[model samples]
Target: MKLKFSEGVFECIENPPQFFASLGNLHDATIISVARTAPGGVCFIIGDVFNNFVDFPEYPGEFGAAIILAGSTDCEWTVSASHLFGKKINDFEVFPAHSADAKYRLEIACHAMDRYVMNFDKAEIRIAR
Candidate 1:
């Protein structure tokens, strides 16, 4: 499916790993941490090695990238977002235009062969490290 992010960023992914890595040209993305915010918000940390590309920054090393996930008004989670690490993104829809404070509209979605599901209303991806 097509992954639509803010700022006219859009790309097609052939696999789950490619989906995350393709976010803003991120490389070697690995879930470093996950946390809860607000009343029911979750933050998924994806670490990436940046600045090695030709157009990237001078520094080259691993840094903490941000993928903040939250809900509009009390988001629900059938499965913890933290446990999604290494799970295949079977399918997902990221409405960047409607996403605000991490708002991501859903129409029946799950990743990792239906092993995990997090109802998020807000989502933001920061590829730069």
Candidate 2:
């Protein structure tokens, strides 16, 4: 019932739109639990947040948090959990490890100020002049 916050998680908030790179950053965290953000964004509760809550039957896993590579340097992440994610808790001992890994989905939140992202793909088509 004691899960400590590893330092790297801070990047999730500090970096903005960039992912926390390296699995070890999460303490080799097996599960990347997800929550839908109130602002159409997303939130992730990393690592064994469930070990303490499973018996009560709650909280969420990983097929993983997928990394969306934008061009060459930008990256975004996504999350997907099993039906049992927030329900039965851990995967059955009889089964191979299925959930409990780091992975994610991609959502590009181009807010009111990102002029570059908002127009990065636009083109002015014109006949040869």
Candidate achieving the largest lDDT: 1
Model 2 poorest 10 in a row by lDDT: 120-129
TM-score winner = 1
Colliding pairs, model 1: 102-121, 102-122, 102-123, 103-121, 103-122, 103-123, 104-121
- How accurate locally, in lDDT, is each candidate? 0.45, 0.25
Tally clashes: model 2. Answer: 11
Clashes of each: 7, 11
TM-score of each: 0.41, 0.25
Per residue, candidate 2 scores C-alpha lDDT tens digits across 16-120 of 222132112222333334444332333333334233333443323222332212111122223223221333222211111122331222222212211111101
lDDT of 1: 0.45
